[model samples]
Target: MGISVEDEHGDEVDRIVAAWHLERPDLDTAPMSVLSRVTRLARRLDLERRAAFADQHLEPWQFDVLSSLRRAGEPYALTPGALMNELMVSSGTTTNRIDRLEREGLVVRSPSPEDRRTVLVTLTAAGRTRVDTALIALLECETRLLSPLTPEESHRLAGLLRALLLPFERPRTAGPPRG
Candidate 1:
């Protein structure tokens, strides 16, 4: 396939790839063209997220926990295990986060009604308010980031990224189970 240069000016990744190509003529750096962009975009997004949450006096981890609960619908509570799964963190980390949030009066821990032995983490009113505000700020930041792209372009980009991500999202099974 022929590579087309769309614009006159190239970004940092383009420069990096050019440098690598000049340094290692035998190596193929095609993957870096896409993955480097993704990596840099992720770093920028993390900065944006931190700034948005800071405006609401929330740390990113706090926002992660609170947002998970906020998305859980009415009552806004979940087991620590559920939170761990949603946040992709370990049990000890989730426990520590819950403890800190509880101390801040953002969340409260109570016995699960369905199972007395289990504990549920419920978002306090303050937690809900903070998470709601942070979400608005986050959306605003994200919208600004996508301002360069038209809505249609953004939609198409999202679809392409999802397609690229599908392989990682699938389970490690050989194939679909037969009934």
Candidate 2:
């Protein structure tokens, strides 16, 4: 016996495509059928993330910066430039976030011993606790979102998403490479 398309379930995206096909027969909406679902899923995930972080009295940006430091292992610090690169934000924005977090006692900035001119952002004990708690909530929220998929299905979906994202993850070089 072989599986058939009928065995697959149609989602909201399928209905959307059907309507678009009826209304605009000339335009090919095949790409929308997949990308739309991804976009919608991202929106839902963002809401879930907001709720999860809120439960821990933390904002998404705070979690992002703190988690970056937390993941940096012992000492749990990084230069402001490193943080700016990691967060993909402007230097001013990074400085503001670090200042806010510092005011909240979540992190502190100390002059780097190796170079007094350079400042390092270190996560405080409070920041670690908050980030760790927020992470648990985040995982719980994500697990609920993925509950519809079996383990195998989840792995397959993750692999597909990774394949889609890989091209964007590569660093872009300026101009042609020197011989």
TM-score of each: 0.90, 0.88
Error of 1 at 132 (Å): 0.3
lDDT of 2 at 166: 69
lDDT of 1 by residue, 1-179 (tens): 12323334788788778777777869999999999999999999999999989988999999999999999998999999999988989999999999999999999999999999999999999999999999999999999999999999999999999987877666658564333
Lowest summed lDDT across 10 adjacent residues in model 1 is found at: 1-10
- Model 1 stretches astray by more than 4 angstroms: 1-8, 172-179
Worst 10 residues of 2 by lDDT: 1-10
Model 2 lDDT tens row, 110-148? 999899998999999999999999999999999999999
